[model samples]
Structures are given as C-alpha cells and as structure tokens.
Target: MAPIERRSGRKRALVNGEDIEKKNTLKRSLRQRTDTVKKEKPSTDKVNNNNINIDKKKVLESSSKENVEPPSLASNLPKALSCLNRVQPGIQGFIPHGLHSNNILYRLQHNAMGITRERSLRQAVVQSYSDQLANYRILTTASPFDRRVTAMQWHPTLPTTVAVGSKGGDLILWDFTKTEGITFMQGIGAGGSVTHLQFDTTDPSFIYTSSIDGKVSRQDFHGNNKTVFLNTMDWSYWYCSLDVNYRSNVLVSGDNLGNTVLMTRQGEKVWSHRLHKSKVTHCEFNKQCEWLLVTASTDKMVKMWDIRMVSGRKSALYELPHDRPINSAYFSPDCSRLLTTDQNSEIRVYGGPLWDKMERTIPHPHRFFQHITPIKASWHPIHELIVIGRYPDPQFPGYHHGENRTIDVFDANTGDMVCQMLDGSAKGIISLCQFNRDGSYLAAGMGLNTLIWTDVAKLTTQGALSVNKTISGIGLNPNRGSNTSQRRRNRRNNNDDEVDKLKKKLKTKTKTKTQTKTKTQTKSKSSRR
Candidate 1:
C-alpha cells in the first residue's frame, strides 16, 4: 500500500511540472508580440513635425489613390494605325475608300475611325497638359539665416543662380547647378531688412541691394560689399523701395519721406521729386522707355515720371488714384497696361496715358486688411494672370484668426480665381511674392521660410495645343518645350568635336605634304648636281 501511494505522488508531481512549462511558454509569446507591436507603432513626435513639411500634399494624394495610373492611349493606337494605313504615302490627305479591296464596309469603318482617332489625339493632348500641370512641385528650399527672407531675385540670364535677402540683413547667394551641393555665399550685412535686390546685368557675381535703413549697397558673392547710398540725413527717413535700370546705369528709388529719387549707379542723385504726401511704397522702370519711372506711395496715388524732364518739371505724366495705400505697382509686359495691389485687398488694372481707364478690379483672397503687413500680388509674364498669397480661413478648425498662408492665382483678363496653392499643413504667413522672369517659378517670402512653387499658370502653350479638334489642322503648336525628337537632334548637333578634329587633322596633313614636296625638290636638285 505504501509503494502504490508513492507512485501516485510522483505522477502528480510530473503533471504539475508540465503545467508550469506551459505557463512559461505563453508568457514568452506574449512578450514577443508586445515588442513587435511596439516596434511597428509610429512615435508620437515624428508625426507632429512631418505635418509642416510640403510633402503633406503628396501624402494626401497617395492616401486617396494608391498608384492609380493615367488612362492608356495604347488601345486607340491600333485604330489610328489602321486609319493611317488606308492613306497612301506621299499624300497629306486621308483615303475615303480602301483601294483593291474597294469594300464599302472598309471605307465606312475608316471614315468613322478617322474622326474618332482625331478626337482621341486631341483628348490625349489635353490629358497630357493636365498631368504636366499637376506635377508642379517644390524643387528645393534654402533658409540659412534664422531671420525672415525679405526679398529674392533670380539671375536674369543664369538658370541656377538665385539671391535672397533676409530681414536680419544677411545676403545669401545660392547656385543650384553645382552637383556636389548648392553653393552658398554670404555677403556683408545690409543696414536693415533688404527691401529689394537685383542682379548686375554685366557681372554675374555682382548684385544690387536696398535696405530699410536708407542704404543702397552693392555686393559681390565673394563677401566684398560697399554701401552706394548712405542715409546721412535725419536717419529717421528710410528707403522704402529701389529699382535699377542697368541699361541706363541709373537707379530709381523711393523713400519714407515721400520722395521719388533717381541716382547714378555710383550713387549720385540725378533727380528727386517729393510728389506723394506719405511714404513712397514702390517704384518701377518702364521696360519700353529707359527714362520712364513709375512710383506708388502710401498716400493712395500712383504717378508715372519721365526722367528726361527737369527736376522741377518732372511732374507725373499719368496719375492713378486709389482708395487705399498702394503696396505694389507694376506695368504689364507690353507696358500698355498697369497693375497695383492696395491695402484694400484689391488688384486694380488701368490703361491709357493717365491710367484713368479702368480695365478690371480683382479682389484678393485675403481681403480683410486689418493686418498692418500689406500682401502683394504679381503679374504673369503674359499678363494673363495674377498670383497672390491668401490668408487662412477663420473657420478652419484650429486656424488662428489672423494670417492667411495660402496662395491664390487669378485670371487677369477674365477676373476669375483660377487656382490656389496651400502652405503645407502648417500655418505660415507669406508677406511678399515675386514671379521669375519666365513666370515658371514663384518665390514667396513666408517669414523665415521662402516657399518656391511651380506656377500652374505656366500651361500657356499646352492650353493652346489642346484648343483645336485636329492636331495638325490647327497649325498651332502649344507644347512648352521642343519635341522630344527635336531635342535629341539638338543633342546630336552639339557633338561637333569629331568634325573639328577631322578639320584640324586635314590642315596638319596639308602642311606636312607641302614641307615634304619642298624637301623632295631639293633632294632631286642635289642628286642631279
């Protein structure tokens, strides 16, 4: 009886040990699962910071459509080929009937096919433009200084060169053509926030800059700089704006003292006029006339001046009055029209000699002018559109009531809002905006951040290409760039080194032959003697 009882006890102990091992296995599995879940989870901090990045737009797009491809034109290709085959070579016109076969069904099939193929080609062209427009994205961003980028200018002739001036008086020169990295050169500091900046037409390295402290300066990318215009007067008066006409070697400037002044490139005051009752907000030179200058002031007036007249007789040739302070005044590409943005949140266009002819008045997106910082609008090179930054809506869930950080593009001729660009997911205020020479890119000064956007209005040629029903029949090509085959041909043409080498070899061979002939003649004379 004692032996049997011991055996039962040992069996019970073994069962309990097996149960303990099972419990330990379950715990280990639970721990491993918890670690895997933790590893996959997004850290809370990373999510918050990425919201401000411009890639938010791309993220929004990806979530809505997972790699959805554009409609393929391949299916229509065979039909188009069949229609083309019906037509004979050396002929521009299409065939109404299939020869040899002479089948009525074949002729009718191609007749319908011809119309359908042309329509598809036109639709494909239109679709291509829409896709091109959708691809406008931020190429790159540079903000070296902690201060706000106040003004920026692209080199008129150079594709990759750009200059930016910040509120902290720092000048940053950036060149994108370098493959190693973007080359950054910091020049001498300005007196105050750089209100305006431009490139030297003759010298790629030199640039002109104007500051709020009444100092106009010239700086080279090598850090060498000299103040061309100094404010020795009351010091209370600061330069409100400055513009240089490199063709005439003259500078047209405006100041807080309500003075419109013209000076030489060396900084000698040639002409000065105190026309506005308040600060002169902006000044522009007419592209058509080197002597013509346009000035807009906070006193609600825009005046055009021909610098050829005497200082006393330098009265404005045209007077444009506004209900609010004019922040910016620009002439159209043709110089036949004028545009201005006012504190009233309006973009006004005028024509005629006196600019009394009102063409259109388009309102900006950020209409309430309660803020002191005035918003600016720019003209597309073709004069077909104007783009300005829009203020945020007050009703946006977490939006602050004050500044609108988005951009609104408007049609100048039709006075309609065409498109808009937002400032990522974060709230940022763009104080000023400027279009590049070709109107391909737009640079907006958003506090310390300079937002560069691919302007959607650049579809000027594509929009033209899609207008007509037939591709070749319209006789107008609206492609923004050269045809792909033409571009390849150009690349081939650029490789002329082989031809140059062959020409050089021929010249050398001819010289050697002439020397050999002279030597051989001398040898023959020697042998005869």
Candidate 2:
C-alpha cells in the first residue's frame, strides 16, 4: 500500500508540470501577434496616403485638360507643367489647376517664341568681342624738326635715345630721358628725303640714312659732323635701301634702278652689281656680312643677291623669279631664309640648298597666300613667324567698298598659315611692321599713328595680335659694346689680309719675270757688241 501511494504522487506532479508549460506557450504566441499588428498598421496607412495623392494629381491634370475655355491656355498647360516639374524645389511654388492655365499662357508668351535658339546662340557668339579686343599704350612719341618723318632709329645701347630723319633731309637726335621732353642732341641736314635709316652695329652713335635725293649720308648722333657716304645720282634714280657691315666697315646701298653698290666706310668703292632690271626695293646684311638685296619694278620680278663675292665684282649669288612686282623683301632672323611680298598679295618663302646656290630656284609652298597686296613684312626675332601688311586693292577704291586692308602672320619654317587681322574700319594702309629687338613688342606704322603691341599676352590668348592700330614709326633698342666693335675690326682686317696676299703674290711673279728678261737682254747685247 506505501509503494502504490508514492507512484500516484509522481504521476500527479508530472501532469501539473505539463499544464504550466502549455499556458506559457499560449501567452508568448499572443504577445508576438500583437507586436506584428502594431508594425503593419503604419505600413498600411502610408500605402493609403500614396493612393489618395496619386488620385488627386490625376483629377487635377484631367480637370485642367477639359477646361478648354481658352484654347491657347489649355494647349500650353502640359508644356508649362512639364517644365515646372523639371524645375528644382528651391526655384518656384507648386501650381494647382485654377492658376495653372493662366501661368501656362504667360510662360508661352514669354518663351523665345518663333526664334531658333541655335541662331540666337550663334548671334551672341558673333557679337561677343569679349576675347578679341587688345590693350595698347604709347611709350614715347618724338617729333623731328620736319613734320614729314621719313625714318627713325633707336640707339643700340640706350633705349631712351632716338634718331629721326625727315623728308626735308634733316637728321635729328632726340633724348627721351629729358624733362624738357625730347631734347635735340644734334641736327644734320643732308639735303634729301631720308628714305631709309639704320645704326651701325659696332657704333651706335653713328647712323646711316639713304635718300631719294641720290645720297647716302652717315652722321654721328652726338656730333653734328656729317659725311656723304655715296652719291647715288650717277648710279641710279634714287637710293632705296642701305645696310652696313659694322664689323667690316663695308656699306651696301641699293638704288631704284636695281643697282647695288658696295663701299668701304672710308668712302672707297669696292664693287657694284646691277641686280634687277627694275627698282631695287630693300637690302639686308646677314651675320656673315653677306648681302641680301631685293629689287622690284613695274616689271614684276624679285631678285635675291648674295653679295659676299661682290668685292671681286661677281654676279648675284641667287635670283628669285616672281610673277608680280615685289613690294618688300626680308631675311629671317636666322639669316637662313628669305621672304618676299609681291603685288599679287602672295607671301613666298624660299629656303633649303637653294638658299646657298646662286642659280638654283626651288618651288615654294603653294598653299600659303595672303590674297591682298602686301606693302611691308617683318619676321619675329625669336620665332618662325612672319607678319605682312596689306594695302587697298587697286581694283577697289574706297574703304567701305574696297578690299579690306589686312595683316597675316605665318609660320615661316613650315609655311603654315597662323592668323589674319583685317582692318575694315581704318582709312589708310599699314606701311610697315617691325618686331622689337627682344621680340616682346610688335610695332606697325600706318598713316600718321604708330601702334605698339605687347606680344606675350596676345600670343598666350589669341595666338597673335590684331592689326587695327596705326603706326607712323618703329624702333628697336639693342645693346652694343666694345667687343662687338673689335669683332667687326677683326673681320675687316682678315678681308684686307686676303686682298693684300693676292697683290703680294702678283708683285713677286712680276719681279721674277722682269729679272729673267733683263738677263736675256744683257746676254744678247754682249753677243752683238
């Protein structure tokens, strides 16, 4: 009976434990269901709000479309709404249907209606001169004794000193550093229109000027003493260009009749060569003192001469043929190239082995054309750039009706077209273009005004400077020293030595033959006696 009682008590305890576990499981599942319902309630509310807003938008859009009292207003609403939707939130207010039609009509009327946006954009670009204009400043302007200024030169060593020549044959020196403004250093009246002027590389104080009055005059800038270097009256119609070999004291002058005369600084004539059948336009000297002279005539031909052998009276080393009259010729800064501007407005470059051969003619690059009659051309001192100035076409007369006076710059080495500047507003033509000695500034001479341009900033932005301003005079300041003079004297002495040796050899041979003849004559006289 005691064992039966213990087994019944254990069964009763096990049954009570199973009943508590079932009640705890039911409470936990009920709490989980309540928490899930709390989370799903907010999600269901958000979905209902979204459906209501979508329905409202559709109703407003449909209402606006159906209320077509004003046809134009209704037609423009969709476009305006589309544009408004694309606008960012910070821009304007969100619009409803009542004001939407009016707003659409306002926008449609104000919109660039009937205008091609592309055409308007192109017009804006064309009218924008924001990047094209240039800033120019005048440094100094020194008027000479005569109002007709023909030529001017800056001192090689002093930037503030300048020599000016007048059409009245007056050479005036002006000191720019003076407070009295331009103080006259000296005046030399050489009795001719000073057509051309240059300073001696060896002596900056000594200046040379040539005139159409048939005279080449040399003057000391500090002293009033003047010397007539050569009289061109007997040689030709007028003296057009003058270049001096400061190291060799050899002066070369070109005349209107295409005659080139080589003379010593002491006024001894060395040799003369007739290069062109027409007028000789300009002349230049290379570092080797080899002469490069160009002649142009109404006859339409430009000739280049290598006058290094002219001391021996030889013909020109080279002659370049042209179909039109050459107005100007320039030797590049390297002295290895030549540029000739002609009446046909073509800028031709001649280079290669033909530069050395006197008779060899090489075909120039054909694609390079200026297309306007060029009056003057200059080369950039440090770059392979050539700048040319154009004149009014003879076929056209006035400024408004005539061909535009233009300036063109080209890559001299590769013959690539770089930039063009057209002056349709100006009245006169550009007469000359000159690059400063450092090549930092480019000066152009027009009718009565001189234009000076800073080259660095323009080249950085627009690749080149525009040719609109007028320039009447241009000057380059280069430093000269005793070393330069000594070098020139040494070169001159070497040339003198070569000539002396030839003369000495001839004298020796003549004496030897004379002695031989004397011996034979004495022997024959003794036999006769």
Candidate 3:
C-alpha cells in the first residue's frame, strides 16, 4: 500500500510542476501582447495626426480661393500693377516708373472695354502721318565721320538736333534745322565706336551712349562733357547694348559675354546677371511697361523679363527661340507689340496681352555677314509701320528685283510693303535708319555718311533735292556706266514705253466698216488708209 501511495505522490508532484510552468508561460504571453499594443498606440495616433494636418491644409486652400474677389470687382481696379504682385514685396519701392503717368500702368486698365475710341484716334493719326511720309525727299547728305556709321538718334526735345556715332569712335551732333548754315560738331573717341545712343527723356540736353570699348557714357548733345556711367574693363567683354529709363533713374547694359548689369543714373551698380549664353546684341526696357525688359542674344534667343521678378538666377518670364542669331528686338511705340529681326530671313511681330504669341512673320532677307552693318527693322515713332534696309540680293524680291536698292517701309499690321524710299542719290545699302520723334523726318546711315530725308511740303524747307539728283557728287553708282544690270533695267523700261505707244496708235486707228466696199476700199486703201 505504501509503495503504491509513493508512486502516485511522485506522479502528482510531476503534474503540479508542469501546471506551474504552463501558468508562467501564459503570464509571459500576456505581457508580450500588452507591450505590443502599447508600442502600436503612438504610431496609430501619429497617422491620425497626419490625416488631420492634411485636412486643415485643404480647408485653408479652399477658404483662400473663396475669398478671392469677383471678376466684376477686379475689372474695376487697375490691371498693370497687378503684375507687381509676382515680384518680391520689397522691390516695388525702388522702381518708381510704375507710377509715372507716361507709363501704361498709370493709365486706365490695360485691355479694358470701350477702348476702341482711343485706337481709332491713333489709327487716324497714323494715316495722316503716313500720307505726309509719301512725299518725303532727301533734304541733304552730310559726311559726319570718315568711319562707318553705326548708330544714330535724334534729340528728344530739339527738333533738328541729331546724334550720330561711327565705328571709329566719332560722335557728331548735327543741327539740320538751318537751311543756310547747317552745323555739326564731332567728338573723337567718346567710346570705341558708339554702338547705341539714347537721348535722356527727362533731360533732352543729355544723351547716353554704349560703345564697343566696354563703356557707357553720358554726355551733352554737342558730344561734350562725357562722363563714364558704367565700364567693364575686361578685354573679352564690352558693352554691346544699353537702355535708359528716365522715370526710374536706371540704366541697363548688356555685355558681349552675356552679362547684363543694372546701374543707377549716377553709375552705381544695382545688380548683374548672366542673361545669355552668347553676346547680348540688344537690350530694351519697355517704355509703356517700364518694369518689363527685353534682350536678344546671338545664341538664337530673345527673352523677356519682368525686372522685378528676375532674382538670383531665376528664369525669364518668356523665352523666344530663333532659327538664327537675332539682330535686334524692340517694343512698338504703344508697347503692345514686339518686333524681332533674325538672320534666318524672318521678322516676327508679337502682340499682347500675351506677348509670347507671334502675331505676324514678315519674310525679308536681311543677311548677317562680316563687313556690313546689321539691318534691323525700326518702328515709326507715330505710325504702325516698320522700316528696314533691303539686303542687296538680286534673287530676293524687291523694287526692280533688288537692282534699284531702296529702304523699305512695311505696314506692321498687315505685313504689306507700304512704300519704298528709292533715291538715285542714295546708292549702296542703306543699312541703318530711324525716324525722328515727330515722324516728320528720317535719317539713314550709309557708308560713313548720314542722309536726311524730310517732307518738302510739310517742312517748307528750302533746297530740298529730288531723289534723282546727286548730292555733292556722292550719289554716283560704282557700276552705273557699263553694268549689265543697269542696262537691262533701262532696256526693259524702254520696251514697256514702246509697247504702250504702239497700243495707243492701234486703238486710235480702228478700221471702219466700208459702206462703199468694192473699188474704193481696194484702190484707196493703198494711199488714204
């Protein structure tokens, strides 16, 4: 009995130990499960918090959108200054041109309704001015310099004072208003061959000049009192172009290595940027929108920038690509259109409110080559017409198929040939030309000489020569006497005249139906007919 009891007690003790281990195992499993739950609680909370932040952001966006003004209210407010919103808040204080009355911003809203009346008035003025331009003839020709003429500008206020620059660093101020005593004074080496010139709008007595000598200069109309406004002394870099904004008291200049620098009128540098890859051939500030700037580069690009938004290597507002190097880009008189001349035989006009869109493309050959002045189409000061020199290519279509070289004036809107300024005296390529501020006169630079043309009827000036008359023995063509092209043109005109005369005679001598047909018609026809 005792042995049996001992075996059963041992079995009971082993079973009890097993039961104890199972209880421990169960407690450990429970603690592990609780620890996992605690660890996951913060993670789940974090996910919920992220969801809440997303909801808040969406709601804020919706609320902001809802708070926007209605279109009706927005239309009543000004539009031009709205572009200022895109600029940094701190920049508006420095650019005062935005508030000037002459700029477009100070006027009624751009693209506003009921503006057709203003447009109609402008069109009427253009028509009257264009009619006067048709009667224009060369007033005189003056040799301002012995070097090739590069740039020219008329005084902003002085009606007859004109500034001319040449490739050999000559600046000439000519007063053509005098009929008897035409006077011109020249300064040598103002800069190395002034490439661009602009008369100060605020002070017409002063003029700004950009030159190939890496300098920008401000001087008097007499080409005296020159003060260097900006200079890039590096040998590989020189100022190729510059523009001044009188209202803002700022000047922007671009160099050959694509560096564009902004400076105060007093010659303090504001900022500089590498705006192009190659040479910056042209740079202009929009007169109407003074904050806007345009630049053309030999890298086959024309870019527009809102100077306010061009901060720290930012991209341009719009980038226009060209098939070839661009000669120039200019804003129209109204600043509503942009014109660009490219070497690949294209002249493009871009219109607003979005200037990026090309409105018209005029196919004209103004070739780019060495040893010739670049032909850039210039805008008429008062009319919507453009003038450019016709490249001397016989294959290109022109007046007499380029045989009689003439400066062409094209209607900007329709891209139609408006008029050809053909003069027997002004031979050779008229590479550079610009209309006076009044649009009453024009000056063209042709091979070291400047030719002035004016309306004889309007100006009432004496000694206005006919287009066919040579001026001071300077109008003779080098190949005029025995040139095959000239002979061919003369022969063609003669043939046309002879043909017209024969046609007139035949028309007058029509045969009548012979009533007395038989003998009289046969016998008298030999003598009387």
Q: Rate the local accuracy (lDDT) of all candidates.
A: 0.62, 0.54, 0.71
| Candidates arranged by lDDT, highest first | 3, 1, 2
Model 1 residue 250 lDDT score: 88
TM-scores of the models, in the order given: 0.57, 0.51, 0.62
Candidate 1 weakest ten by summed lDDT: 467-476
Best model number under TM-score: 3
Clashes of each: 2, 10, 0
Query: Candidate 1 versus the native: TM-score?
Result: 0.57
lDDT of 1 at 513: 100
Model 1 agreement with the true structure over 1-529: per-residue lDDT tens digits: 1222225644642235444554555445434533453365433323222222222243335423544322232223334323432545685876543432323454446557774344334333333333433445444344455455777888788655668877667776655323233344543444467777888888867877777767767778666665567563545777878888878888877788787778888889887778788998888888777877788988888887778883542366878889888888988888878889887557898874556788998866444354324677777664356677776556434556655466666666667665556534224666676767776666666655455556344334344322211122111121222234445655677667778888999999999999999999999999999
Top model by lDDT, which number? Answer: 3
**CA RMSD (A), model 2:** 29.8
**Cα shift from native, residue 315, model 2 (Å):** 2.6
Residue 411 error, candidate 3, Å: 1.2
Q: By how many angstroms RMSD does model 1 differ from the true structure?
A: 30.9
Off by over 4 Å in 2: 1-149, 152-154, 159-164, 170-191, 232-236, 289-299, 306-314, 356-374, 392-407, 414-417, 420-427, 455-529
When superposed on Cα atoms, how far off is each prediction in RMSD? 30.9, 29.8, 25.1
Candidates 1 and 3 compared by lDDT, better number? 3
Task: Order the numbered candidates by TM-score, best leading.
Answer: 3, 1, 2
